[model samples]
Target: MTNPLGIVGAGIGGLTLACALEQQNIPFTLYEQAESFEALGYGIQVSPNVVRVLAALGLTEKLEAIAHRCYGFELRSFTSDQTLIKWQLPKNQLYYQCRRADLHQLLFDGLRDKSKLNFATRLTGYSQTTDKVALKFEHAPKVEVAGLVGADGVGSPTRRQLMLDSQQTKPSYAGYAAFRAILPWRSPYEELAGRATVWLGKNHHVVAYPNGNLNHGEQWLNLVLVVKESQWQEEGWTIEVDKSQVAAEFQNQSRLLNQILKDMIASPEPCYKWGLFTRPALPFWSQNKVTLLGDAAHPMVPFQAQGAAMSIEDAYVLAQCLQRHQTTEGAFQQYENLRYQRATRMQITSRKNADIFHASGLKAIARDFVFKIVDAIAPNLMNLKSAWIYDYDVTKL
Candidate 1:
């Protein structure tokens, strides 16, 4: 009998890839290090591009049940809280704001065969031969795989071993930190429901949107505060922090900002802060029978809000390539070729947005002025600008 394909890391990318592979009737096993899936308490944007892929996987109704469909996006000023640009999102294509854990759960439950999922299985290393790859584990016996996919996220062991030359390089800090929290949806912020909002400030910005718990029938708001920070150098998204650490950074700010921050702090939910970091692009993502996917291949700053979306797209494309090609090397090569340019573009653009969103002094004034003019002349152009990204359909690829 033919050996099954093996996938490492059961993140959004890994789970989505498993679903896609199942649709193609490809045999595979998914390995996850965590003993069980934990609920992540952050909001994730699911743009139309990724919604296309999820819908293809028979998750449309399930997604609608858990996610809030965003009708538009508004950008406001930090000091005045005045709207700089407001545009309705594309009606034909659906955009959603949902809790990361809810979406993760939906994807996990979407799989046709739960038996293929192996939790508490940590991959230590892997060795590849011409015909198959052997995956090493810390506790269990090694498993031979016909083809190996490293969906392991940032600081991936697979990437480290694959790129012997680049092993010495570390992830460069993006000179910023992000604080994420969730609060109950209330009257003062009732206008924020069914829409996404951003308050752009000097060297900082805030994003807030409506998300809810479907199981409990409760309404909630998700908040993310990003600010310039060069002193602290910690990484990872789950680092608990006192709200004072965030409040201290925004002294003498507008009342609107203060109220939101206060709401975030008063919430019973835990608050998390993590430094933003980006890694240098890999020269190649594939080597022989093995290749990387999602943050494993390219970890980017979150300014563009496309980090998860790109992973979802990558999952579908990689699975299609694997099914289309006969040899594992050919499949890996084609997957990298198809995804490298698009993923790199997202990484670079996300980095540039950090500066754009945090523009201050004359740059900030000029940026707001341009937004006003564009908002007056042609608001649709603002939405059209992202057409390339939202209009993409990976299932068709």
Candidate 2:
């Protein structure tokens, strides 16, 4: 199709979509609110599901060089300091934990030269006639296109303009805060092999994993601490926080974990925090020539670690839908039909995992018991259970 497709947000979802559409010989333009395509933040888990999508885009070699392959996730009890579950990951499936910047670069670099990726071009408003959509930008010239994609994330301007109903569900605070930081590898922990680890405690949890290429000496370790809180001010993930404050929150944690936090807090850089938020399921993902993708369509808790994965899935499926259908609207409806249920299920599952991960009192003990039994009976159960998610091949769909 020669009709130009416009995408807002150059995030994982938007960039991936741009690349996929390009590969399919589709014409498109990508607008990013950021000033430049600079890498941001600490680390993210790219499960086999996401890896499969990246591989389809021919990014395997570049990504593999920078990502740490984790065999599985180990869950431990914070109070007892005992291993509760050691769920073996998928056998043939490889999971990578890489710096967010490195992943972003891989996607950004993959876009075709013809793909117009305009930075600092924020979406201000948009209007649609019977045949085309006209997009207005904050600092750039307006453009008319066959379709507009709202890959702009949870605070999507397209969503706001399209679904203006006062009753529409807004993203609410999830009553928890997460602090993520990257520390230089040092000594014992440095020598320790790359693996993902989760320490679960009452009302909080800590997840750590090796990030960056293993060949680049010892890789940097990424740490994320989620704690229940009464108030959260920031709504976006990039909001800044005091490192000392974050350190204080985890001071009562295990000594070993506390040491890690101290090192993170002592870093010269400011720590960031954001209140996780999600919208109630929208009845549909599209209207006219406009549609949502990634966090724009479905935002989920990070407990499942599938936020980026879902967006990757959306990117591939959306391109497929457009390729298979005659009109933009038809393609959108088909995309929603194929994606809504899966995204909603993932959102619910992530929420459920949050409850389990943050269990307190007797509930925490029960959770530990279940983990032990499951680990003993089926060492690979965790990996097996997520097979339906991780093993999915979107290209074949």
Candidate 3:
């Protein structure tokens, strides 16, 4: 009997890759470090590019049933209360605004009958021979996989064992921190039920959008606040934070905005906070039979909301490369080549957005002015600027 493929981390990237492999009738096992599937109290934007991949994977109907289709994104200046830019999202393609949990559940349900998923199994180490790879789990029996795909995320242990110096470009605090929470859709903000809004300031930004459906009683809004900060030692996504401190971070903003932050803080649920981190592009994404995917390969800031989208793209393309190539090593090389430039470009662009959104003095004025003019004359063109990103169809390749 042929050995099944082994994947670490049951994230969107991992699960999506697993589904793709399953579609091709390739056997695989997914190991998640977590004890069980649970909501992580965070929200992520599913851009059209990612939506297309999901559609190809036969998940569009399920996703569309639960997600709110965000029409356009608007950037508003906090000081002047004026709209800086209003770019319409791509048409025909659907962009979902659902919680990470809802999306995860969708993928999990899709794989419910696969009989190959293993949870609470943490990967401790791995060894790769010329033809196969063996993985060691902390509390589970060792399993040998035909190939190891490390979708284990930014702090990937598999990547640590395989790479020469995986810790060299360690995730550093990008001089900023983010606070995210989900609120039940109430009135007043209900006007924002369908659209995504970005309130931009000198060194801070607030983004809010609805998720789930109003009729299904699953309607909720996801809000994220990014603020410039001096220090951040914690690196994981599940870091705990003080509510008042989060509210204080945006004390200088408008009262209405502060009220939103205050409501989020007062909620019974715990708020997760973390210093946004990014790693320098690795020279290569693979070594022999082991390769990296998602945050393990390219961790980027959330400036462009492409973090998860890129990972979804990686899973699709990596699967494609593997299907096309004869050997694991060849597929890894091609996957790196096809994905490296685009991911790196996005990483650089997301960083630039951080700087541009936080600029002060003359730079800030120029930035705002450009956004206004672009919104007025060429709104569609402004939206199409991201066509290179949104229009990417991995299946064709």
Best candidate, TM-score: 1
lDDT of each: 0.85, 0.83, 0.81
Better of 2 and 3 by lDDT: 2
Each model's backbone clash number: 0, 0, 0
- lDDT per residue for candidate 3 within 54-113, as digits (tens), equals 889899888888788888888888676577887777667577788878888788777744
Give lDDT tens digits, candidate 1, residues 1-397: 1788899999999999999999999999999898977655478989999999998889998888888888889998977788899999877979888888888888888888999989888999999888999999887789999988999988788888898747444466778888888888777887787788998999889898988543346667888889998856454545899987786776434666678788776778888888787887888989998899999888999988999899899999988998899988898899899889989998988988899899999999999999999999988797777877888787887
Off by over 4 Å in 2: 165-167, 190-192, 234-237, 252-255
Choose 2 or 3, whichever is better by TM-score. Answer: 2
Higher-lDDT candidate of 1 and 2: 1
Candidate 3: list runs displaced more than 4 Å.
112-114, 234-236, 252-256
**TM-scores of all models?**
0.95, 0.95, 0.94
TM-score quality measure for candidate 2 = 0.95
lDDT of 3 at 226: 88
Candidates ranked by lDDT? 1, 2, 3
Error of 3 at 291 (Å): 0.5
Clashing pairs in 3: none
The TM-score of candidate 3 is 0.94
